[model samples]
Target chain A: MTHHAPTNIPTTGPDDLVVRGAHVLDPSSGLDGVMDVRISGGRIAEVSENLKGLRNIEADGLHLFPGFVDVHAHWRTPGREDEETIETGSAAAAAGGFTSVVMMPNTDPVIDRPVVVSGLVRRVEGESRVRAYVSAALHEGLKGERLTEMRLMKEAGAFCVSDDGLGTQSSGVLRNAMLYAKDSGMPVILHCEDHTLATGVVHDGAAAALAGLPGSPGSAEDVATATALVLAAETGAKVHVTHVSTALSAALVGFFKGSVPAADVTADTTPHHLTLIDELVQSLEGMYRVNPPLRPEGDRLGVGEALRDGILDFVATDHAPHASEEKYLPLEEAAPGFLGHETAFSALFTELVLGGSLTLSRLVGAMSSAPGRWVGDGAGRIEAGAPADLALVDLSEEWTVRADGLLSLSGNSPYLGRNLKGRVVGTMVGGELVQDRTGARFGSRA
Target chain B: MPARNLLTLEGTSRADLREVLDLARDYASGTVDRPLAGKIVCLAFFEASTRTAVSFELAARRAGADVISLSERGSSIQKGEGLIDTIVTLDSLGADAIVLRHPAAGAARLAALHTEAAVINAGDGRGQHPTQALLDLHALSGHLGGFDELEGRKVAVVGDVVHSRVARSIIPAFRAAGMELAIVAPQTLLPLDAGAWGLPVLPSVDDAVDWGADVLYALRLQKERMTGGSPRVPSVPEYARFYGVARRHLAGGAVVMHPGPVNRGVEVAGDVVLDASSLIPDQVASGVAVRSAVLALSMDVARSRVAA
Candidate 1:
């Protein structure tokens, strides 16, 4: 986990965007050897080294892999576009080696029905170079009482349904949807903050009491996650926990590890929750402000252990964006999410990879394979038939997180000026070059 | 020869200062209970005051009243509203009483002429913080077993008195009670008219304590007013060497007092403030009692007029 100064290797040329593999490591397909991945039509057209002079990029001291998939995020869309938008958010996704993302449906026009669902899909398709999937809310505007037209929303192409920012207050409606979702083969993603119990932001503990700051109590996350697990167990439906920030959520994941049938539960934890502690908040100024506020030092280190042990599933960018002016608004009034896409790989490498709490195998698996499997994605593996959506990275490179050096449009990032030990050198979305490390330019490889 | 000390006050009387402390005494006992049910203590601090602001606000509320701490900052004052206009605005708000802290001496008295509501001086430009002086007296009387009487005691006033409103009001109380007084400070920090009161003004803390004064009242080190004065007191270490009170300064069973939010190791040693004779914390506690008394007495007088 030692990082010397990185070699100033030149970035990829326009003609040869990806290198022929020197050593390719794809944990999803259990493939680890020299392999070549090719580009055409913005989708994986071929995966052979001898597939005719197809832009032979140099692969010396580099690792090529699939672009990541993030299934849960509050883009702060429609309503609070100052925090994040479809174009800026997709650029964030692509910068972190994410080719596609499942956008949370808690915006101005809460995606509860097919019309709102189709609107977001069209917005992303129209404005973004990346594919964006919308998760329709469980109830109308996520009020948690009346259910929206679930079958109609699925027909309109929502991958799942979730009350992302808050838990469904009505258990009966949530149960009904889970059963219906089980029948339709669609999962229900839940945010897991029981409204009646959640009083404020930040983890409520002795530390919060001393500081006179309000606490986002653990019982709220515990009760919501437990409730969701029981509904998932009873209905035998697939459920995914979004932004799992508490220790009890990790504990509940362990508690329900093998207890139910037809219960395919996966969770994604964010980068901010992993590295930053409450003490760090005292120093990081205010950029560390986020939902389920930052955890205490114990919870911060506990998440690292959870990632290493594989109790937690993937380390998601949850890659939320916010404006500088909006973020500077005092603690109570500031936006809830922070930018993570540009800093995701570098931060993950610095913490899990360089810090020695997580392995390269699990990092790739969680970031790529696990998200792909939960959403029925074709990438996360570099096998013969898998799509050529890829992320070529320099494992030996040590770089500091610079705001001016990101491909994402938004300048708000929590890891601004943080020194990290790894970075994404190249990114291919469906065989098309979406991001290149040289000149840090973004274009299609097709 | 130690110089004789004199204190200049706007109202000029030893008897009047005793009346203030006597009223402060009744309030300190919590015996004078009146909610001032419909009364308002308008705290008009034109500048910053943390302790004074909070103490006055709490005093009004604890007696079953309400308080509206009008912040002078970011108000119409910034819009060129003069002091007279601000006073009129406060009067219109139906303030039962106004506590005024201004940068000019006599501003509180001027403010009183402008409004029918009673104006309590919360300290006007270092002119006279008479309430703080009365509370200091009340604290000394209670701690030293001299309640309702100060006929023959000795007090040593040390530290800055040249520009302190607190010193201006406190000296008369000791003088009117037929007690001995000692003004001890450096030449620059000493009042210019020290020889007029016919008492001793020793030049150092050790010299004052050696005269067996029954109480030592330490003035806050007034750095804010120490401009254009040469031969100023030395550095903190040198100040402590020449004037800062220590355990050695308690030459007898004398009590120690300070008007606080004290600067540690500057005007007084940290441990000295925590010593056996220090009534500093008790002085802060007495502030609430003194204010409640002021509010009640002022309200009663106002009420009698309405009844008449």
Candidate 2:
């Protein structure tokens, strides 16, 4: 399999610097202590108690971890630049301590052909602040009818293929696409939903009944997930299910994992799914509207347990952004999504880690190493010979999320007005400072 | 009562219901007072409505308030004006109350966010029609003698309860008014886990009559429910056979009610609609008075008058 490295253009080459005296934690490498990490040629050269370099950053009392990798996000470039551009989206990811994000290809003129894939890669290289990988659409225009050229798309720099905004209705169509993706060595990211059952805007529950809104049953997600898993077992294709909101879907993934050991299936649940429930939809606010809609408390707890038990593999911020006009309407007419890139870690930290449902190390693994391994980059580790993708966080600091304070162009986050305990102070991609909130500079380069 | 907007009737108190019903009774008795003389009421209907819109307009005019009407067709709303923009415009025009009928659920709540005006939800998609519930209660209470006499009275909400905004509002409001409620609909036409509402699910209209129901509140059988791409009911005849309240069902001294623009023979027998026991006409007549009470209460005009 040919590895397509995530594309990004750093302003300066090969920083010779040291991140000093920070509580370095890399769960994958089993290093959890205060250490100085040295970087040379944009790669971590050493991690020790005391390391000195020409340029040093004093990161005392802060926590440093490998940068997060978001396997699912919508940058909304090329089509809805008004909602989010690649530059702003990457900056938001950097602020959220995400070093690498795979962009979903449901843009205006959907990214199905090799030309579109190559064009997006070039745009990411030129405009993005952090590494951004392109995932070409599995179906042309995401219509789920005709398969795109997956092998050619991978050759043109696509790391995966997805038709994220919509689900493939036909099992035959999805199976054919999976076969093509398997041959092309591209992982298939499935957003599973039976469209007929998902006709309602919110999760079908007591909240929907009370609010009198139309509801989509969890069977919608479960049925589609079962189909995808069965086909994955049959086709021997690598399938990564994004935004597994319902408990049954996660259980389906777990069931398939044991039944078909060689199926090669992984699943992710979003931070919103981990913490929020369908009760929020009772307010009828559009910001709470999302695809695979926020489920009941039982489903929320079940999905969280799945992630904690490793039945669900990682955390991916399906960071979909929409303009205010699109989001601030009535629930039925509003666009379905939340601005996820900026709040992924803080939300998880406040809700999961601090709440004792998940340990910080496990959270780090899910956000960083697990997804990074899936991305096939060998990136998300603070070790020698690995890319210096890192985040400096002030874990003790308490900050409230505000729309005006978010780096993303759209202020559609459900976390708006939430007080979180941890905040990303600084972020580095390949030893270059992509985000700096330290308010102090240690030294200048020679 | 602390909330300015009457978005839903789910959490409404008996005292609040009494206040509205009493005022509506007085208005029906030809009470003369202009509590809303200085107020401006804006009627914004993004969906088509005949009874709700006309009655709200008549209610506001009868209370001597200045009225402004906006409909989806032949208006700036038709030109792609958002609900928020229209709400802001109404608020900016010094509207003291905005009666809204929108085609999306939660529209009244969303509109309440953008404006200071008290939003009265006439009907919002498949969501609540709070005022309709209020007027229904008023009509029923009048027929039953008084609100105090409504206690332990059994009413069966029959047919298409899932898609009916009327059912959504009436279920809670009627329950809060001390009426014991049961639902009579096909399994396909019921909400998810309908039994979770703590109400009995009677199988047929005959069973509802056998269960000693005092009232048979039938909801309109929407045309789409029977003829749409995926039919909820097999046919109109099949729906009427089991769920419709026929004239024979009224032998047990049960009255029939429907929120209208009703299909005459679908949810209720055509002859049964004009039966002496049918309160359908009274439900419509109660609209203007009950809406007047609601508008006055929402604007705090009635509250101020009581305080004075």
Candidate 3:
């Protein structure tokens, strides 16, 4: 078998991240044109046709687009560098065209209070080239009880309140959190996996029985999702799903699209979930393993189809990272979730875009503006007053995902060495160069 | 017609019939990412297989479709996820094809049940592994120029025949291809229906060897499969002394073949698999490719009728 092809990087000058020539695409602004954006003092000065005394660069072979915003990303700070420090995670985000990411509060010391949220935000700001936002926990410690001080955390710079690593089963607790969230004017992004049906591993199906592992059935996610929706509708708070990996959950998203006010309920599916399942996970050993574990291949395709049909909200890399030594066990024993930040867009492009399941505009909308609208983030559109958060992608470059040399700290991407037909060549955050071909100019690898 | 590859024997004209030769070629040469796109397969294996079962499962998945492996271990036959209930369950679950491996002969045909999906016989106890037999035929054709021309060619299948399911299945397939088979085992080892299988039976491997054997297949002891013991070989050492393929015997380019999990020296030398004429690896490789095509074809047949 062939190892993944070496990443073919363009031999170009390394100044600031600039793409002067490619067609710009921003679905939120109805923008599609050959535009030029000028970066100065780490902010967009202008986006016009031509300008003298500017750093003249070539972007003829690519497509300029708004930087993707992953509202739900499990980006740990340098505090625990072994399990995805901020630098490594930010590098992954940059490679995926994500200039801004709202990290989930599921670290060792879960970010619940203003102090924790502020600490994480400042840590990421000081360490990462890519912009980082904090989505602190709703409950004090994510113990499934007692609402955290949502207002104080938001004022202290928490982007949103989310109990994402797990969901609270008690309706009273959820209702209180959403009620608090409604008051705070922020959404509660929930990880819709019911603990009652949570088997600590994967979906209980034919594959689970054959492998003799515990099953994390679809009913679990469905129940939690329904409960969250019921609470959201009652409290009038926005509820979003972090990483949806099942068809049963996807059908609920379809219901959301047609449901009244179309749910303020948004959901995102990971590229790993969109591409693989329990059977493939079993074949690849525990390497194919992930939480909300890869549902079967049927569900994988269903999640992709739902995204294409506008039933699913967006695509996010619940890019949880773990040390390499942790995955040396069977399906049930190994840790769940795969690192997918770097290969996110490429895998989606291969499965949905190249397979003709999703159009390019749809892909851009789901990856960028959709999440932007859901989180109320400033990143996504390329309108005149918008921040210069952007990405330059070459849609025709056929890149291969090689695990051994992957940028993410964890080598858990299921698409390792899978053929992909597109690549993000350059990424910009506030018009400053976060990542490009030469090397990261912010942190050591950021 | 797009030339549907029929997995069943019924309603298959010679024109519709996919020749064993063509199936082998398609498997060997063709490649597709989503060969079974928008499809689902209900895999029913009555018996267990670690290698073959998992291989076929991987093949179906690699073709990009859904696969529902029915739980038959804790099944209540009719009241349970038995053969029929399992098929019905798959139908309700929107399965587009079925890969059936049963202990009963002709189970693949019986399980088709009028759905549009192709019912592929992964293997049926002693009924047939048509794909395996076809692969065998293709191997023999390559070695001896063609099955039609193997009029005088001799094959030595030693040890057990009475309890060997492979012997029963390959007999008809070989007969269909017009190749004469030489059953080389003792009277205790030979099945009473051996002549009814329409082949000349011999008393020992030496008979075919003396008659200039073109191929040798040393059968597995099959201890796990045997419910009761029949004296096929007086002793394993005795059988090996008389019929076991030695290195010197296969030096003349005569091939050695076995289904697998070869019992090192009891049946044949350890070096036999690596010998220039062994067909073992090629046979193993074909299991995946042929199953992929069969899986894809089955799905295409069922896709139109199975609903979202």
- DockQ of every model listed? 0.02, 0.62, 0.02
lDDT (10s digit) by residue, model 2, range B1-308: 33378999988888889989998887778764777899899999998888789999999999889999998789888888989999999999998999999988899988998888899998998889999999999999999999888889999999887788999999989988999999999977876757657789989999999999999999988788776545789988888899988989998799999999779889999998878999999999999999988998888787675445
Clashes of 1: 9
Leading candidate by lDDT: 2
i-RMSD of all predictions: 23.1, 1.5, 17.8
Q: Order of candidates by lDDT, top first?
A: 2, 1, 3
Q: What CA root-mean-square deviation does each model show from the true structure?
A: 19.4, 2.1, 21.0
Candidate 3 structure quality by residue, lDDT tens digits, A1-446: 11111111111223343446678788888778887766554445566776422454467767887888787777666355787878788888898888778788887788888787777766766666676777879897798898998888887777788888877878899988988888887778898877767743656554543333445668788888888777777777878877877777788766765775635777888777777767764242556567777777788888888888777888888887777655633343357767877887888887778888888888888888887776553568776556667887888888778877677888777777778888887787766656685343222322
- Residue-wise C-alpha lDDT for candidate 1, range B1-308, written one tens digit per residue: 11111112334466655555566666566655654667776877876788888888887887767677766677776565656667788989987788777654445655676676777778765456767876777777778666445657888888876556676667765666556788888765643334534568787777877787777888888554333324456577777776677887775777778887676776677888978789898888888877776666566632342233
Give the poorly placed runs of model 1, Cα more than 4 Å off.
Answer: A1-18, A40-52, A283-285, A407-409, A439-446, B1-308
Model 2 error, position A301 (Å): 1.0
* Clashes (N, CA, C under 3 Å) per candidate: 9, 0, 5
TM-score for all models, in order of appearance: 0.60, 0.96, 0.57
Q: Evaluate candidate 2 by giving its C-alpha RMSD to the native, one decimal.
A: 2.1
Pick the TM-score winner: 2
Candidate 2 Cα deviation (angstroms), residue A223: 0.6
- What is the DockQ ranking, best to worst? 2, 1, 3
Candidate 2 docks at the CAPRI level of medium
